[model samples]
Target: MTPEARKNAVRWSVFALVGAVITVSLLFGGVSDFHPTAVVRKVYDEVEALPDGSPILISSDFDPGSEAELKPMMDAVLEQCWRKNLRVIVMTICSPNSPELADSIVRASADAHGKVYGTDYAVFGYLAGGSAPILALGQDWHAVYKTDRGGTPCRDLPAMKGISKLTDFPLCLEISAVSTIDYWILAGNAKYGLKLGLGVTAVMATDYYQYLATRQVVGIIGGVSGASQYESMTRQDALRKARETKEAGDLASARMPTQSAIHVTIILLVVLGNILYFAGKRKEKASP
Candidate 1:
């Protein structure tokens, strides 16, 4: 076969192997003895420890661009919250389109868990004006979020009960792919003392360790890999849905094998390409 065709065959074979790994990982959960990160476990433990009927806020501050990474985290955490019977108030502050993107996931989880709207959960939707709105949440949530996404008055919704300001909620997790977490850290955690946790894209995750160390962030779950770890802990401690497609942890863990496989494949292909190029040049020099 031509060198090009032979290389193509090898590449396709690697891809097929990756596909097999993904299938097996999805069928059975990822890498055995997958140790859950301490930070992720901390978040899971904190959520599990909350009182059955207490409220928590989840702010999804990313648009569709971050859906792959943040959606699984959101799903896993929401499932945990639902299992614990904690009230959830979800909102977004980054993109105008972020609210609807997150709402579908929330609704799906609510449906899966038999959670009711206005009672068990509420979507405050997107709040504009950047950090100002977040600061307003600190001052008076009722003032800023006068109503939920459905236009029902905030005062009328059971979800908002006992939540006068941002600090009233014991924990607020900011899931973002943007700088919105900075605003939450400043306005919500630093100023109002809202107990904060975070979920961020992989690249953005390292930036928040200082916040975690300072206790500004209760814990931080970063990217799909982090979601995979969080999923493990959730399954072991709070709830376990064995191979359940709808369960976020299972869904997230399924993606990890695929991601790791693809990454390894790319690195191998790059190395192979360089080796082939250098070998070809050596052959040419020897012959000519």
Candidate 2:
């Protein structure tokens, strides 16, 4: 075949393969279920083990750009926290959009778990000054966030009582798509000896694994696949508690089938391309 025709053939093959993969994924769902990774399982186990009414801080630092990937993890974590009856304290410093997103996710999860606002959980909204705010929080949370997201005084909120600093909480969880986790590590963990866990984008996952290895981060949940694993674990926990499966739905699991299909298709294409390249090279050498 002519060079142009060969290129065209490869292009068309890729298109067909991608289309078929999408179709199958949409119709049949993801090809396989993912077992929970050790890191993800550790996060679940830590949250599960927290005593009732234990206060935990959550830093949600991503906007809509990462909602699809990080939101499910946040939701699953929130569900786990609320189910265990832990007091959740939420805050954000990455962007102005973050606080609202964090608030909505926390509220939705709180409502689902029959948790009360200002008592079981309190949102501090968006604090300014980037890492400075985190530092301030570590020093004095009441000074950093004098009021809840709704303008209610932090002193007035029952959940905020006795939570005067970052070290006051036994566990601090951060679901971040940016370098904010680094700030948390520096200010909260390194400085104040705060126990930290993280949920990060796939790209950022490797960046933070070193922290996990060093024991700075107690555990981690990385990307959508990580989220799916945590969701599965949470679902099982819910089942054991209620004696039946909960219908809260798993968004990460729903997206996995499509991701798995595309990944397999791409792998097949790579294998085919290599085989064709070798075959063409042999044919050229034989054309005496």
Which pairs of residues collide in candidate 1? none
Candidate 2 global TM-score: 0.87
Tens-digit lDDT string for candidate 1 (132-215): 998888888888888898899999998888989888899988999999999988888778888888899999999999887788
Model 2, span 54-149: residue lDDT tens: 998999999999998999899888888877889999889889889998888888888877889989999887877767987888888888788988
Provide the overall lDDT of each model, using Cα atoms, as 2-decimal numbers.
0.83, 0.84
How big is the positional error of residue 128 in model 2, measured in Å on the Cα after superposition?
3.1
Give the residue spans of candidate 2 off by over 4 A.
1-16, 30-33, 237-250, 280-288
Ten-residue stretch with the least lDDT total in model 1:
237-246
Structural RMSD, model 2: 3.3
